[model samples]
Target chain A: MHSFFGKQLPVAVAFFSGVLMIITFFSGDQTVADFSQEQLVWVTIVGGFSLLLGVASITRVSLSDVRKRRKGWPYKAVLLIFLVASSLGAIIEGTERGTLYDWLFQNMNAPMMSTMFSLLAFYIASAAYRAFRARTVEATILLITATIVMLGRVPLGELIYGKLPEITDWIMNYPNLSVQRGIIIGAALGAASMSLRIILGIERTYLGRQ
Target chain B: MNHDIVLFLEMTLAGFLTLCIFSFLYKDNPFYRLAEHIFAGLSAGYYVGLIWHSVIMQQLWVPITQNGQYSLILPGLLGVLMFTRLVDRLSFLSRVSIAFVVGNTAGISIIQQLHGFVLPQLGDTMSRFGQEFWGPLIILIGVVSTLIYFYFSKEHKGALGITAKVGTVFIMVSFGAHFGYTVMGRVSLLIGRVQFLFVDWVHSFNKIIN
Candidate 1:
């Protein structure tokens, strides 16, 4: 009974919902389209609650660490405290305009994310220096192309050479565009095939063990 | 209680956090760790509140309470079932929720992948042939050869080997261009932070001083 509901039922549900969505896309029926749209909303609602799973997992781990007095228990405690505080603030104040939630997000969250992401700049430069060595024919081409593109993208490139931008544009438009299109076509085909497989129940990986 | 004072405080806090995060470039330290953890916790909490307010309150709560739509309870139940994964015996119940997501995404993606990606790319590639003489010709060749290179069933030998080599060159050039573009993006982000520090914050402080 457990297996029937847990495993088989879900598979059936997926097949039906997926087929319905496909029908909604291709069929001209207004009622079907409306129902499918409603189903999409349901999916979003389910996905929204799914976010709590992550919070629950993180909270559990943090609590366990605090209880065991792990190496970074203090940090874990800080994380839990902030998590609780921020969640409470947002929930209590409401996430509407001119709220504490918005203020925290704008001031703290956005800056931290952008700063963390920006740190990749230093790392990427270091990586390029190490990896873009002109050791072979291919490596040499890659190194030159990368240098040209990087230079063209920045204001410093124009200062160094006026034609650098034009050359960069040509490379990006012709060769880069061609290769990208090819990659995109191939990926789309692959994705379509994979989607088909999943819909048809050929892909059972999502079900996880039986 | 001047608005400028609050704005200044917010800017200063953001700058401080940004600098703390950037300190990771030197070495791992308590300040960096604290900032990183706080960012993680706060973002997680923010997402929780955002999703609740946006998806649950709007889609589930509002409709059920205000509009009196009871059908939403089905998806709501399924969403609740996902939490059962935390339990040892009841974990299988989560599969139902996963199936719904997987199926719906797979179904919708079929038409979307075809319309959004595959068809447009195919049309674009084909249309390029009519636009210019050599440029489109070269693109068509690159696209075909690249696809052939990825076709692993047949062993690359003779003409296929040469074509595959050309395909490899295109792939390498594409990768190099992508890496350069990514580096540029990251660098721009870094530049934004620098600009904020040197320009915006400095001007604000200057105004306060005056």
Candidate 2:
């Protein structure tokens, strides 16, 4: 029963959906397309529920910590309070504009997230300084190209050299496009093959072992 | 006066959160951790709000009640089933929902990756051949060489080794450009936060005094 539910059942479902998608894609039948479209929407709806699992887990962990009076328990308490506040606020008031949820998001979540991300600006430049030492030919090329691209992006590069922007554009259009395309093709092929494996029930990793 | 006070309070909270995050630059402290916890909890809560409004209400509830789209109920049931993972005996049933999502995603992505991405990119690369000779030539070399570098079936020796070397140079340049762009993005976000602090937050003080 365990094996069936855990592995065989999941794989069988994967196979069915995978085959259905492939058929719908190539069939050129309107009915098939409509059916797949419905299936896709259903999948997205299911995707939404996946986040609830995270909520349950975070709540469980934080509750346990608070119960235990762990170190930094005050922070966990704050987190729980805010979590309940935002989720309940949204549930009661709805998520439309001018709601408490929106206000919380606009004031608290947005600025905090942006500031956290912006901190990486300080760290990444410092990191590049420490890491990009031009130790070899590849390193040297990377350093020079990075410097040129960075400079070209800012107003200072154009002020320093009139042609810097053009050189940056040329590099981006040619070399960057080529390498990115190569990477994309390679990744696409990999993903396709992986999808095939999953559809065939050859890839069982998604089903956690009992 | 009340509305102005509310606005002022909001501005002050946002600025405080912004400063809390930036305090990480000096070192991790109580304020940073408080902001970090708020970020985690608020993001999760925001997602809950979004899913409730966007997915449950819009996708399922309205569609069923208003449009008589009874088909949506199946996905709603499947989504609800995801909560059963909390109970050990019924936990296995959650895999059924997971299977549906995973299968559908894998099935769709195969074609999306191949037809949507690979075919278009390959066509674009080939189509560029009729343009100015050197630019296209350089791109072609970069693509082919980069692909060869990724290929690991055969040992890199002699001619293959040399080609792979050229591939590395292109890859490095592309990587550098990517790095430069990422830094620029982070810096721009940092500038926005700084602008908010100076132009918005500090300006509010003047309003209060006036």
DockQ of 1: 0.78
True-vs-predicted CA distance for residue A105, candidate 1, Å: 1.1
Best by lDDT: 2
All models: lDDT? Answer: 0.86, 0.89
Against the true structure, what is every candidate's RMSD?
Answer: 1.5, 1.6
The deviation in Å at residue A197 for candidate 1 is: 1.4
What would the per-residue lDDT of candidate 1 be over residues B1-210, giving only the tens digit for each residue? 777777788899999999999999999999999998888788788887887788778888899999999999988998998888777788888898989988999998888888998898778778865567888877777787788789788999989988888988887777778878998899899999999899988887877777
What DockQ would you assign to candidate 2? 0.79
Checking candidate 1 for backbone clashes, the offending pairs are none
lDDT of 2: 0.89
TM-score computed on alpha carbons, candidate 1: 0.96
Q: Candidate 2 on A25-132: residue-level lDDT in tens?
A: 889999989988888999999999998889888888998999999999888988888888889999899987899899999999999999989999899989987887
Docking class of 1: medium
